[model samples]
Target: MTNVSRWAAMLALLFATAAWGGLFHAGKLVLNNVDPFWFTVVRYTGASLLLCGILMLQGKVRWELLREHWRRLASLGLMGYGMFGILVFIGLSYSVPSHGAVIMATMPITTLLMRWVFERQRPQLWAWCVVALAIFGVSLVSGVWRSSTGAGHSTAFGDLIAFVGTVGWIMYTRGQASVSKLSVIEYTTFTAILALPGLFAFAVVATLLGYANRPDPADLIAAIPPILYIVVVGTVLAALAFNKGVRTLGAVHGIVFINLVPVSALLISAAKGSVPNGSEMIGTLLIIVALSIQARKMGLGAKAAK
Candidate 1:
């Protein structure tokens, strides 16, 4: 890409990550009035339709490729979209948005570990150290140390669930190697469409089982604004911008922008008069520093390899 294009891509990625940072907060608002499964169903209903519309307009549906890879796409969609959404939203009901953001910021390191376990691609010793630092930072951000004191225990628990959700996302990302023939937008649209049935099923089951209550029309109305933000900015726009930026700037360079996720979340929270505590601030800084170091190392290694 040209320098101008690269700069634009980087700017796009910055905004994308910031939008995603705001997602946790927006999701929390919706979850206050809607159950996790229903929220996922609602969000993806709009997102999937819009994405399919985009593909249809572009004449890039690639039905043959989708049919050939139906099973893998469905499985990944279930994990990444269905499972991640339910768990994270449930967790958000108990935790704050900044906490969720910090936990998710660990994704790159977790992806590295997943690579090690699944692909046997061992990371260097320094990489392992970075992982440790990231974990420690997450603990501080989640206030895990305060759990035993009957303070922030639920937040810590929620953070754990959120971390597990992040793993689902990592799996979905890694699983993309199998569907490499499809473009990112194509894969995203297909997986989202495929995931909708499973999301709907879960929502139905939860409502039937009394685990989730059907929201009243008033409740849904109250949630409409945040839900709209989540679908339009968080799901569709961020996903498109992120993929485009990563494609243009290269993964190593693009990954560094993840630092903005937690930062933006905290800033948003602060703006709403929920400033982060000292430990949370410190933990956020540590994770950002570690990820920055890791990204720099990876960028240097990539250049050297070239």
Candidate 2:
């Protein structure tokens, strides 16, 4: 890529990371008035419709390719959108948003391990050190080093669920690595379509069990802003931006920027009277540094592989 194009890609990646960061706070706000499953159903449904409309408008709809990859796409939808979304939301209910955000920063290390175990790819020693640092950082951020009472309610459980969700995300990314031909819009549309059934199933269960919270008119109105933000900016725009960044700067380069999400989430929360303690900040910094080193090493390995 040319310098200008690379710079633009980097900027897009940064914006995408920021949008993802804001999702922690936005999701927390939305959960105040909606159940996790219902929130996920609405968010994914809205995002699906918006992406479908955009694809139709751009004359880029490809039903044939989607059918060809239907199984993989469906699995991606179920794992990444359906299960991952619901787990993180439920996990957040038990943990601090900042804690969930920081714990998720370990995704890069998880991705590396997945590649090693499943794809038989060995990473460098530096990468292993980075992964160790990331684990320690997450432990610190989650207060796993401290007494149970020192942490908030169910914080440990929440962090564990978040770790599972991170693993699911890594699996989804690995699945997508096999999809070289699909356009971003095509892949997104397929996943969105596949997510609908899973989301609807959860929604139905919630309603049937009377677990669904009926939003008052004001609550309904309150959900509008965050819902729109998530559907439009968080899902569609961020997906496109990240894809573009990966195309220009590569996935490792783009994903290393995601370490910024925790910092951004912390800042947003602090601005809203949810400031993290000094330990959280230190742990966040350590994870960021570790992930950056890990990503750089991964990029070099990819070059060597090529």
Candidate 3:
């Protein structure tokens, strides 16, 4: 790819990941008023419609692609959009944004292990070291090291659920390669549209089972601003940009950028008057170092390919 194209893709991924960082906080706000089940249903519903509108305006709905890959798209949507969204939000409701962000930062290592297990692709030893550094940095940023201070901002159950959500997202990201014939927007839009019915159905079921409460109309109205941010920025834009970046940079390089999630979360918290502890300050530096190393590696690999 041209340098310009590569840079654009990097920018897109940066924007997407940063927006996702903000999403944890925004989601926390929305979840205060609406439970995870209904919050996901509303977010996905709106995002699907907006994505569909964009697809329609482009005059390329690609019904043939949909018909050709409906099953794959459906499974991806269920796993990524439906399952990931619900579980992450539920985890967010029980935990703080920093915890969610730290869990997300594990994606690079998670992807590495998943590939090794499923595809017999062994990463170089250096790659493991880099990911280990990134994870340690994220742990510091998350104050996981300081959990003994008796802060109740996070819980094991919540972190576990969030980790599962991250894995689902990694699966979704990997699944994108199978549908390489589709454009990023097409993939995101179709998966979201296909996922809506299941999302709404599951939400309804949860409400009926009393696992989640049906959000009142006032609750929806109150959370509209954050919900809109979650849909427009987090779901639609982030999904589109992330897929584009992965397509451009390749998954190994693309996934390393997830380390930015915790950094973004820390910055957001700082902006809100929460001072970063010394560990967080140092951890942020390590995360940036890891990202730089990975980016340089990607550049060298791209040059070699050329």
Which candidate tops lDDT? 1
TM-score of each: 0.92, 0.89, 0.90
**Which pairs clash (backbone N, Cα, C closer than 3 Å) in model 1?**
none
In terms of TM-score, how similar is model 1 to the real structure? 0.92
Between candidates 2 and 3, the TM-score winner: 3
Please write out the lDDT profile of model 2 over residues 138-179, one tens digit for every residue.
Answer: 887877766676334236788888778767655555566567
**How many clashing pairs per prediction, in order?**
0, 0, 0
Better of 1 and 2 by TM-score: 1
Where is model 3 poorest over a 10-residue stretch in terms of lDDT?
Answer: 145-154
* Candidate 2 residue runs with Cα over 4 Å from true position: 1-5, 150-154, 206-219, 247-253, 299-306
Model 1 spans with C-alpha error above 4 angstroms: 1-5, 147-154, 248-256
User: How accurate locally is residue 185 in candidate 2, as Cα lDDT from 0 to 100?
Assistant: 71
lDDT of 3 by residue, 30-60 (tens): 9889999888889988998999998999985
* Models ranked on lDDT: 1, 3, 2
